[model samples]
Target: MKEIVIIGAGYGGLRTVELLSGNKSFDITLIDKNPYHYMQTEAYGYIAGRFDMSDIAIDLQGLIHGLGPNVTFIRDEAVQIDETAKVIILKEQRLSFDIAVIAVGAKTNFFSFIEGAREHTNGVKNMQRVFEFRQAFEHRLYAKLQNSQNSLNRAGDLHIAIAGAGLSGVEIAAEMAFTLQRYHKIHSEKSQRLEFSLIDAADTILPGMDPYIIKKTEERLHELGIKIYTKAFIEKIQERSITFKDGTILPFDFIIYTAGVKGADLIHTLDTPKNRQDQIIPDETLRLQGSKDIFCIGDCTEIKDAKKVLLPPTAQVAEKSAAYVARSITRLSEEKSLEPFHANVDGVFVALGGKYALGILFKKIRVKGYFAYLLKKLISRSYRFGLEIKVNAGYKKRHVGSHDTLCR
Candidate 1:
């Protein structure tokens, strides 16, 4: 059997593993620091307390065990990949592989040049961070309510500033606003007590996105009472305040840094050719430049199209790249010529507050309101169903003589 090792259990890594698990000729090992796969796309809802932990985290061990006995799951951090030796250096031991895939994903770009930005603001990159932020946010609201009877000063009690104003930032702000509205109604408190501001260096929110989607999103944000600050370049981020390049200062009780992301730290340490964001520059076939045995996909690699336009590092792109790479690996084993990867973004769905959303399908059709939200939910369920069905099928294949209904 050909030894195959995949690092990172993010969208790209997980999908690739799922695609290749049934191949008996390949022995696959998946390595990641966490044992559960965190559903990052559903983070905003989780942060808003609309979803539970189980809704966003999936047990990797259980999934892997069901995948097949040929697949192994290792819960360890990957420190380096020595391409020359065809070995992966982990914190505990080294792993050798006939084919290796690096899909470690991206990390929050705190813009290290800005003073106190990384130290002061919170991020939702991982489950732990999201949980921490949610807890802190709820606690602050509760504390403010308790002190409302004793103190007249509640100046910045519920002030929230989200830096970035991108998709993540916009979603977070809208969800929080909706949640706060619900809280205000339940407590019979004035809505003025709650304040939210979405800041971005770009001239408009969701810059580079479709104009109609951006316009509708802006309208929704305005309806939610969330403020938008454009072209507000951050000079520094203090614990309770943001200093802008134009010498404008904004104060807040809490801040979320959703500004940007770059390739993970391990990607930066690799000796391979990397872009400005430390993402590997893969060839047309999505393999590491000049290296056929190593394939890099997802947020850890920067892939450009025929027009030289860089693809956005979204989950959709990651999954597409992953599927292509998995097929390419199988083809390589059969001594077939590899095909160039062409990324096509079929659709994008952005969830606003409550059951409201905006979507662009096939890059032409547009959807709005509750229907868009439902479509997004349906799509999420379908993706999860795909993964679950594989697990069930694999389980039946291993234990039973025939494939049968094993899950309700």
Candidate 2:
């Protein structure tokens, strides 16, 4: 069997594994730093205590255990890849592969160059960091409620300042506000705790999204009790406050930095063509332009084609790219010509607090409320069902994803 090693169990990496799970001719090993797959897009809900860990994480071992004898799962971090020798070196051992796919996604840009931001704010990149913020926020809120030390009208109430009102920041703020309101309801008479604020340097939130959608989202967020501050840039992150570029100081108990992103520094560790933003340059085939047998997918790659503009680092693009690559790989193995990847910019979906959501559907129509939530749940269930069947019966097993049935 041919050996194929795939790095990073993110949207793209895991999708590739699901696509090629049953291939008997290839021994597949998927490597990830974490043991379980995280639903990062929905991670804000987890931070807000709206969803539990089980709700956001899938059993990676269970998915592979169901695969039985075919695929192997190695829970390890990949440190380096030697393309010439087709070898991957982890912390302990180096493994060789016939074909390798590098889809390790981008990290929180940190923009550590900016003074004082690193030590003060929590980033939304990995699961551990997000969980840490959750713990911090909860701890402060609980302490405030228990305090005989502070007066009821004192200035020590729980204040959460989020420094980026982009998609993640705004959504997280809305979720946190709603969760805080729920907590406040139970302890209403004694203490008034929990204030949420969203700060963005942009003129408005969701800069890349439709203006009308942005307006609607902004209004809905306000209705949910989240304060939004636009056209404000952070000059420095202080111990208990955020100093704006305009010299205004806002104090808070917790700060979440979801501001900006750049390609991972690891991509620059090698000699590769990079765009102005430093994202790896990839050809239409999704292969690194100047590197042989090296493919780049997801947010780490710079997409320069006119047909498909550089997409936001979202899961949708990663999932689509992974499928395209898996099919292309199979085609190449059979001595067939490969197809170029042309991504269709589908509509964006933003989940509001509770069952409410707003986004363009099919890039033509607008959808919100219960119908959108139902669609989101249906998508998740369909994905889970398809992956489950793929593992149970291998690639030879025929499966259909139909709404009436579970696996459509």
Candidate 3:
């Protein structure tokens, strides 16, 4: 049996396992730092207390039980790789593989140019961060209400700053705004208004989204009284406030930084060509250049187009790469040629809040309102449910997803 090692239980790695598990010729070993598979796309709802923590995560160990004995699931951090010997180093042991896939996902990036941001600001990349953010947000509101500060008394004092106007940042801002509205409605006397500020260095928000959608989204956010600051460069973030490039300081009760993300640290150590962001550059076949046996997928890999521009690092692209790479491996096992992976931007769904969403379908069709929100929920659920089946059956008939990505 060919020993196949996958270093990530992310959308790419887990999907690859689900696809290749039934191939008796390939013995699969999956490794990840976390034992549970979490749906990051819809996690803001959980952060805002609209959904349960249990709603977004599926126990990976439980899922692996369904993949049968051919597959082994190890919950451990991958430290480094020795490409000369094709071995993956864990905390204590080294695992050799005939074929390996690197899909270790991304983490919060405060954009290195800015100082003191990562150490001070909040980020919601995973469950741990989400829970922390929820606690901080709640604590701020609790303090304000306990002090009996009415909406008139607390204006900018209850300020919340979100750095980056991308999907996650904007979505969380809307969720918090809506949640605050619900809270104020219940206790009219303790109506402490929150001031939400969305700061992005970009001249415009939602870089690749439709103009109409952007306008509608801004209008929706305005209904919640959110302040948008475009073309605003962040210079530094202190514990109590954020400083801009022009030395403008905005005091915030708490801040969430959702600006950028790159590959996990392990990917940077590989002796492969990498982009400026330290993302591994893969060839058209998703194989790491100079190492045919080792493939890459998800946010960690850089699969650029003919213009040398890389695809946006998103779950949908990862899904496409995962399926294609799995098929490539299957063909390789049978000594067949591999196909080039050409992933098109299908569309994306952005939840403005828990109940409202914006979807750009097929890169042309624009969708919004409640139906878009329903579609986002369905997409999140389908992936989780499909995983449960894959965990049990070792392999399930393929499930297709619309080109739905939250972040561009």
TM-score of each candidate structure, all chains considered together: 0.94, 0.90, 0.91
- Per-residue accuracy of model 1 over 213-242 as CA lDDT, tens digit each: 999999999999999999889999998999
**Considering every candidate listed, which one attains the maximal TM-score?**
1
Candidate 3 residue-pair clash tally: 1
Once model 1 is optimally superposed onto the true structure by TM-score, how far is the C-alpha of residue 334 displaced, in angstroms?
Answer: 0.5
For each candidate, the alpha-carbon lDDT, in order, equals 0.88, 0.75, 0.81
**lDDT order of candidates, top first:** 1, 3, 2
In angstroms, give how far residue 31 of model 3 lies from its true place. Answer: 0.2
Of 1 and 3, the candidate ranking higher by lDDT: 1
How big is the positional error of residue 371 in model 3, measured in Å on the Cα after superposition?
1.2
What TM-score number comes out for model 1? 0.94
Q: How far is candidate 3 from the true structure (C-alpha RMSD, Å)?
A: 6.0
Query: Candidate 1: global Cα-lDDT?
Result: 0.88
User: Could you tell me how far off, in angstroms, the CA of residue 114 lies in candidate 2 after the best superposition?
Assistant: 2.7
How many clashes does the backbone of model 2 have? 5
RMSD of each: 3.5, 5.5, 6.0
